[model samples]
Target: MSRVLVVEDESAIAELISINLRHAGYEVTIAATSDQAQFEVDRVLPDLVVLDWMLPGQSGLALAKRWRSTARTRELPVIMLTARAEEADKIAGLDAGADDYLVKPFSTNELLARIRAVLRRKAPEALDALVDVGGLKLDPATRRVTRDDREVRIGPTEFRLLHFFMTHPERVHSRAQLLDRVWGDHVFIEERTVDVHVKRLREALEPVNCARMIETVRGAGYRLTQQVQALSN
Candidate 1:
């Protein structure tokens, strides 16, 4: 299942799209502001973005351009959704690296079609592979985590949760975002379930002396980071 992050300010519009996307078997998340959208993207890279043209703080155009400039999100497929049908606006959006463009008052059928087309155009990567971060190693092939020549026992869910964190180390992930990514998008699990699993993951790593790396960002979310080491300028 593909994950989509819809960045729309209007609650009605966001809900409408989310409902439709979910019905179509696409895992969907709705972000109502530029800040929220950016935070969501920072948490996990969605398969595709349905971005609104006008936003409250930073314009959608600016957000798209910024994502293009950032290495992590550079190739992120985006479909600009806006009421601005002017040629200039479309061209600007295209220049901003939008994979596709859809004018508002658009039909849900067309929107779904466009999303499918964009996804087909985007290249896919191997999700199962060896990951190593800060001396902690996880091998998807072996389904094992090892540190300092010692094996770490972890549950299936914890293994996957830890895999996501290790792969995206040093970035904050909100419970909602983690649930969408780690637990399948359409999963109806509670947000607190994420906290419980995170705690379990930490306890599993405690034996390896790597538990302190997962830091809780009060009022925000959690992040996996390397041990603090001062760098010389």
Candidate 2:
């Protein structure tokens, strides 16, 4: 089940959101202050955060900005829930790294829909089905990557990158897209980070002679070709 953190200073609002989310089959946690919210995130990162714009101490905008600036929480998905419906306020919330924004007096159904949409976009690889392409196999459940039954040693980031490529084989994915999909959010992460992780993924696949499977498309991005034999040479 996807975990959701609801950060609202008002007890009634927080309880309402929490109850609705729980009823919808989501694991819900509520925080009545920015400090408590930060603590919850530090202890365990939730799949998504429903943050209130105004808080007791720090505003939701400030918290979102802080999370975006930190490497560990940079890719965290956030949806701003606030009474500030002005265009400028909405722009500021988005610029602060909110994936989606909802004003007060919002419908529960609409909020749920937005949460589902953001989670779908942010956690496309939430499924654990095995993916195989170009003789490379990745088992999300086991968290393993292999070629010809030989294990491929890789870091966490590289593993995720390879999983995405293998799942969408032969499709060229731009650096920005990769960052958004693999990193969960692209607003805070640099595009160059994709290059770094791609290099590492290739290095991990080198011993198995599958490094060339990931092709760098000129003037484009990268593609994991299904024609494994052709690239083996």
For all candidates, what are the clash counts? 0, 0
Q: What is the per-residue lDDT of model 2 for residues 8-63, given as tens digits with 9 covering 90 to 100?
A: 99898889888999999998989989999999987666778999999999999999
Candidate 2, residue 166: the lDDT equals 67
Instruction: Score residue 130 of candidate 2 by CA lDDT.
Output: 74
User: In angstroms, how far off is 215's CA in candidate 2?
Assistant: 35
Best by TM-score: 1
Could you give candidate 1's per-residue lDDT for residues 108-200 as a string of tens digits? 999999999988766333256677767788998889999878999999999999988876666678898899879987577899999999999
Clashing residue pairs for model 2: none
Least accurate 10 contiguous residues by lDDT in model 2: 224-233
Off by over 4 Å in 1: 124-233
Candidate 2 deviant stretches above 4 angstroms: 125-233
Worst 10 residues of 1 by lDDT: 224-233
